[model samples]
Target chain A: MDGDHACCEGALAAGCRFVAGYPITPSTAVVERFARRIPRVGGVFIQMEDELASSIAIQGAVWAGKKAMTVTSGPGYSLMMEHIGLAVMTECPCVFVNVQRGGPSTGLPTLPGQADMMQARWGSHGDYEIIALCPDSPQECFDFMIDAFNLSEQYRVPVMFMMDECIGHMIEKVTIPEADKIDVTPRNYTKLPPDQYLPFKPAENMVPEMVKAGDGYRIHVTGLTHDYRGYPVMSADCQEELVHRLVNKINRNEEKIRHIIATDIEDADVVVIAYGITARVAVDAIALARKQGVKVGLLRLVVVWPFPEAVIRDLANKGKALVMAEMNYGQIYYEVERCAQGKVPVLLAGHGGGDVHKTEAIAEKIVEANKCLS
Target chain B: MSRTEIKIGGFGGQGVILTGFIIGKAASIFDMKNATMTQAFGPEARGSACSSQVIVSEDKIRYPYVKRPNVMVMMSQEAFNKFSPQIDPHGIMLIEEELVDPAGLPDTVTVYSIPATRIAEELGKKIVLNMVMTGFFTAVSRIISREAARKAVADSVPPGSENLNLNAFEKGYEWGLKQLEG
Candidate 1:
């Protein structure tokens, strides 16, 4: 199966019962599989008018007590930004899949790009955090998609499943474990009676329990800052309380949410930092560099958001140089450079999209970065 | 082989991508090797030139695309012209004899030509040309086992048309074997 089809299977396995999306290049296969499979699996797959409707409709389904998601690419991701902020402010638990392609606007519809890494973090306006996972292979697409849903339900944040065209379109063997073997996180519904129930009240984890639109619970879901009672609170104090908790819930639990795959980094002079398709391509480059006697290691970001700052900082403290390779002009490079904090030389091996980084080019960059150590 | 990169190229509606899929499926699922397949996207795939790149490896496949294909299967003149220059110096080139004119290829490159479309037509459906080509690829390249390729053909084709497709594959495989012996 391809990554897109594996993603659909993952969604089904994770109890995703509703999907609303507009067909777009590269990402269309995800919803296409969902549409065909959901009929027998007892779910709803709706092709909404555009990205905006698709983004918000999934939120409505989430409120109706269904695990839901929406899929899109670069342009459509741009369109869904406003609603992404809404999903954050209302604390809706849903997955947003961005099968990234080239573009500031309608760029390469059929090619791969990692330019949306920054957008996945800050595409939506305001001071809120969301979980994002980058899967490099078809197998991880299935495994991480389930994690994306579980993370969304765990923190009540809109989890972003960030995939590039290469991973989404590439076909590979994917082993799906038996349903009994797979662990699924059920939504945390409040047990309090209708009168006693407060939808926005936080548990010790700072993540509030959820309630659907019905069930006789009085709830007010709003984009504006709200109190524990779920009513709109206009003061800066309420904003401080609500927004601070929203950001803190993720920031405080960063260690639990971060997923990094490090290889041969203990005595390395140069480290290659990459996510999504770039990480897969960098594997070959790192091998080539190693043959030329450069101690280049790889730090593949499986969980790209929350930045994995501590790991990068730890590496910068010891490693001689870091190479950030991505399909864009350099989105995550700034983040890596920031975390390095002048401790080492940080370089960018950035492309303008359309295709993946050349293995030779990346190898050359690694060799150059290693020279700086000497 | 540690890594074998194969490119199946032709115009769209010719099952170019499906051919690559079956090959990858054979290697990964039946043969127990790792295979990754990616195709060229966009309008050119409608009826114009297009290609599917498949990498079969005993080890894990890291880089997905085929930079220099160890095997090139061209079903159209455009695909032949477009991709033949990038073939590995010691690679094997397979082509549809009736459709492509193998003019400028290097002498060192071993070229196997088959009238796959004609063979498929004799099998009662010209659309099965890709299957015939796939069978020929299995026999000549020897990368995927015959049993594995046959199982993949059956597993991939539409349910009702399995017999015809399998027949097409067998015909191509037999023809390829004859070519090798002679």
Candidate 2:
């Protein structure tokens, strides 16, 4: 299966009952699959007029008690920003897939890029946290999409399924497990009656229980600041409380949410930190460096946002230099550097867009970073 | 094998991508080697030439695109002219006899030609030319086993068309063997 097709299968397995999307290259396969299969699966796949409608339509489905998603590329992603912020503010549980292409605006329509990593984290207007996952192959694309949906359901926030064009279009063998073997997290539906329910009331986990609008509940959900009663509470105190709750829900549960694969790190003098397609490239580079007896490790960031700060800090504390490999002009480099906190020199094997970096270039960087062992 | 890169090229509607797919499937699924494929083409769907690259390796394939193809399969004159320049000097070349002309290729490059379209035409469907080419590729290069390619051909084609495609495969394979023997 190709990555996009695998993603569609993953969504189906994860119990996504509704999807609204505007098709764009590289990302179009997801919607195309959904449109074809949703009829048989007894779900709805809506082709909205444009990206803005596509973004908001899924939120409506989510509020109506449906697991939902919207897929897009660069320009579509940019248009969906306001809705992403709306999702964050209203605490909507949904998934968003960005099959990234080169772009500030409509850059490389059919090419690969990882420039949207930072944008996936901060494109929406606000001081809030989001969960973004990067999958390196078709198998990971299938597996990690389930995790994306499960995380979105568990925490009432939009999960970003960040894929690059290379992974989206690349074909590889993917083994999909039987449906019964898959574990999916169901939504946190409130058991309270209409009169007793407080829609915005936080549970012990800081995520409020959900109630469908037409379920005879007093639902007054709005984009503006609201209180536990789901009414407009226009004040600085309410603003502070709401923002803190939204951000801290993800920040406080970072340990539970962070999924990273750390390999060969015990005796390593340098590490390569990367995610998605770049991680595959790093694998070859690390192998090449190993041929010369350099013990380099890899920290594959499965979860790109709520950035894996503690792991990077520990590596820095142990005096291990880091190389951040990405297909962008230093977007994640500064983030890694911030986490390293000047403890060790951090290098970047960066490709601005269109194609992946050569393994030799990454291997050469690993050799140079290993010089800090002394 | 350490790594073997293959590029198959033709006009857009010639199942160019599908040809790359079967090879990858054969190597990775049946032969147990890892294979990765990526494609490129112009905007025109039929007349414009397109190409798909596949890398088969004992280890995982990192770079998805071909750097320089160790083997080239050309099914159209435009495809032959456009992509033959990047072939490894000693690479194996597979050509569709009627559609491509390989006059400028190096003498060191081992050439294998099969009338895949004519064979498919004889088999009553020109759409299976890619499958015929795939059979020729497997027979000539032996990079992927014949049994594996046969299994992949059965798995990749549409339902009810398996027999037609398998026949196409056999025709190309037989022709490839005779081309090598003669």
Candidate 3:
């Protein structure tokens, strides 16, 4: 299957019962498959008029006690940013699948890009946190789609399934295990009677148990800075408590949420940090660099947002030169540089992302970084 | 044992992407090897140029795109003209003789030509030309076994056209064997 189809199948496997989307390039296949397959899976597939309607429609489905998701590409993703902030404020447990294409606005609909890395982190106005997973292959698309939903439900946050067009359109074999082996986080419902349920009250992990609208819980969900009762409370105190819980929930649990696939980084002279399509190309470059006897390794990001600062800092502390390779020129390089903190040299091997980074170019960077050491 | 990169290019309606898909599926699913297929096409569905890159290897395929393509299959003159020059000198070329002329290509690259469209026409369907070429590719390249390619062909096409596609495949395979011998 293609990566988009694999993602759809993954959502189906994750018990996603509602999908609201507007058709967009690279990501159209995800919702198109959902429209075709959701009927058999006993779900609602809505085709909204635009990205705004589609983005909020999934939030409504989530409040109605359904595992919901929306899919879009670059332009559509830009349109949905406001709702992304809304999802964060409402503590909506939903998934946003962004099969990113080259874009400031509809730049390359059918091509690949990783330009939205920062936008996924801080696209919407205000300070908040999000969970974004980047899948490198069709198989990872399938595997990580389930993880995206599970993380969303566990954190009561809108999870971002960050995919590029290369991974979205690339075709490869994906093995889906049996139902029992797949782990799904069930909806955290308030077991307390509807009259006593405080909708915004945080549990031990700072994620409150949820209740459906028809289930008779008095829910006052809003985008405004609300208190634990889910009501609009305009005060510095209320804002501090609400914003801290929303941001701190993921930040405090970094070890649980941060997933980086690092191979041989601990004992390397130069480490290549990459994710999505760039990671695959960097792997090829790393192989060639290794053949030439360079002490090179790779740090492939499974989770891009809540960037893996500690892991990167540790690598930099070892005095290993780090080269960050992404499709977008310099979006992620600064992040790595900040983590490096002048401890070691940090370089960026990237472009604006119409096409993938060439293998030899990345290999050349690795060799040069290693050459500077010796 | 090492990686073999194959590039298939033609006009959009020629099943160029599906040709790469079947080859990748055969290698990865049926043959238990690792393969990845990435494709690109223009907005126009039929006339515009389209291409697919399939990488097959005994080990995992880390890089997705084709670098120095070990083999290239061109089903149109435009595809042949566009991609043939980029192929490595030691690579192999497969062309649809009815549509593409393999002139002005690198001298060292071994070139094979077949009238896959004419053969598919003889079998009463012009659409299965890719299947004939895929079969010929299976025979000539031996990247995946003929059985593996046959299974993939049976699995990929529409239900009613499986028999016809398989027949077209067999014709091409037989022709490929004859070419290898003659």
Candidate 4:
């Protein structure tokens, strides 16, 4: 299976019963599969008029008590930004899948890009946090999409599934386990009676339990600043309280949400930090660099957001030079540089989104990064 | 082979991508190897020259694209012109005799040509030409087992057309074997 199709299967396996999306290149296959597969499985797949409608419709379905998601590529993702902020503000636990293509504005719809790495975190205009997962292969695409929905349900935040076009279109063997073996996280529905339930009230984990509309619960879901009773409370204190919990729920649980795969970093002179398709390409470059006697290691970010700060910090403290390789011209590179805190040199082997980086280019960067050690 | 890179190219609607998929599936699913397939996308893929790259390996595939293909399959003259230069010098080349002219290819490459379209037409469906080429590829390259390729053809073709497709594959495979013997 290809990554896009695998993502759709993963969503269905994770109990995602509603998908509202407008078809876009690279990402279109995800919803196309959903549209074809949902009817037999007793689910809804709506092709909305536009991305904004698609983004919000999933939230509507979520409040109707269905596990929902929306899929899009770069241009559509840009149009869906306002609703992403709305999803964050309303604490809607729905997946937002961006099968990222090259872009600032409709750039290279058929090619891959990691430029949206920062956009997935800060595309919406506000101070908020999001959990984004980047899967490198069709197998990881299947595995991480399940985790995407589960994490969204667990954190009550819109989980961004960041997949580039390379991974989305690439075909590889994906072994799907039996349905009985897959673990799906159930929605955190409140057990309290309608009278006793405060819609915005937090539980032990700082994530508020959810209740569906028409369930005899008075739920006032809005994009505006709201209070514990789900009513608008337009004040600085209310803003502080609401925003703090929205950001902190993800920030405080950073360790629990972070997923990184590190290799041979203890004694390496250069460490290559990458995610998505770039990470797979970097594997070859690392081998090439190792042959040239540069002690190079790899730190692949499986979960890109809540950026694995401590891991990079530890490597920087160990005096390891860093190389960040990505399809875009340095989106995650700055994050790596910031985390390194000037403790060591950080280099970026970046490309401008039509094709992946050459192994020789990345290998050269690895050797160059190692040169910084001497 | 520890790793074998293959490239299949043709004009759009030639079932080029599906050819790559079947080979990858045969290797990864039936032969218990690792295979990754990536194809050309966008406007060019609709009706113009397009290609699909596949990597089959005993170990996990790291890089997805084919830098230089160990095996090249060209079903159109345009594809031959575009991709032949990138073939490994000492590799295998398969061509559709009715469509492609295998000129200027290195003598080191073992070139095999078949009238795959005419053979498929004899089998009553010209659309099964890619299957014939796939069978020839399996027989000539010996990268994937004959049983695996046959099973892959059966599994991949549309329902109720499996027998016709398998017959086309067998014809092509037999032709390839005769060429090798001569």
Q: List interface RMSDs for the candidates, in order.
A: 0.5, 1.6, 1.2, 0.4
Q: How far in Å is the alpha carbon of A207 misplaced in model 4?
A: 0.5
Clash pairs (backbone) in predicted model 2: none
Runs in model 2 lying further than 4 Å from the true structure: A372-374, B41-47
- Candidate 2 per-residue C-alpha lDDT over B1-182 given as tens digits, one digit per residue, 9 for 90 to 100: 48999999998778899989999999999999999988862253346678999999998787778988999999999989989999999899999988988989989998899888888888889999999998889888888999999999999999999999999988888888888899
lDDT of 3 by residue, A320-342 (tens): 99999999889989999999999
What is the clash count for each candidate, in the order shown? 0, 0, 0, 0
**Candidate 4 — number of clashing residue pairs?**
0
Query: Residue by residue across B124-164, what tens digits does model 3's lDDT show?
Result: 99999999999889888889899999999999999998999
Flag the better candidate by DockQ, 2 or 4. 4
lDDT of each: 0.93, 0.90, 0.91, 0.93
Winner on lDDT (2 vs 4): 4
Residues A267-369, model 1: lDDT tens digits: 8899999988899899999999999999989999999887789898998888569999999877889999999998888989999998999999899999999
Model 1: reference contacts kept, as a fraction: 1.00
Candidate chain B TM-scores, in order: 0.97, 0.95, 0.95, 0.97
Where does candidate 1 stray beyond 4 Å? Answer: none
Best by DockQ: 1
A best-first ranking of the candidates according to their DockQ comes to 1, 4, 3, 2
Residue-level lDDT tens digits of model 1 in B1-182: 59999999998888999999999999999999999999888875666679999999999999989989999999999999988999998999999999999998888899998999999999889999999999999999999999999999999999999899999999999989988997
Model 4 chain A: lowest-lDDT 10 consecutive positions: A213-222
Tell me the TM-score of each prediction against the true structure.
0.98, 0.96, 0.97, 0.98
lDDT of candidate 4 over B39-95, digit per residue (tens): 888986666678999999999899989988999999999999998999999999999
Which of the CAPRI classes, incorrect, acceptable, medium or high, describes model 4?
high
Q: Give the 10-residue window scoring lowest on summed lDDT in candidate 2 chain A.
A: A365-374
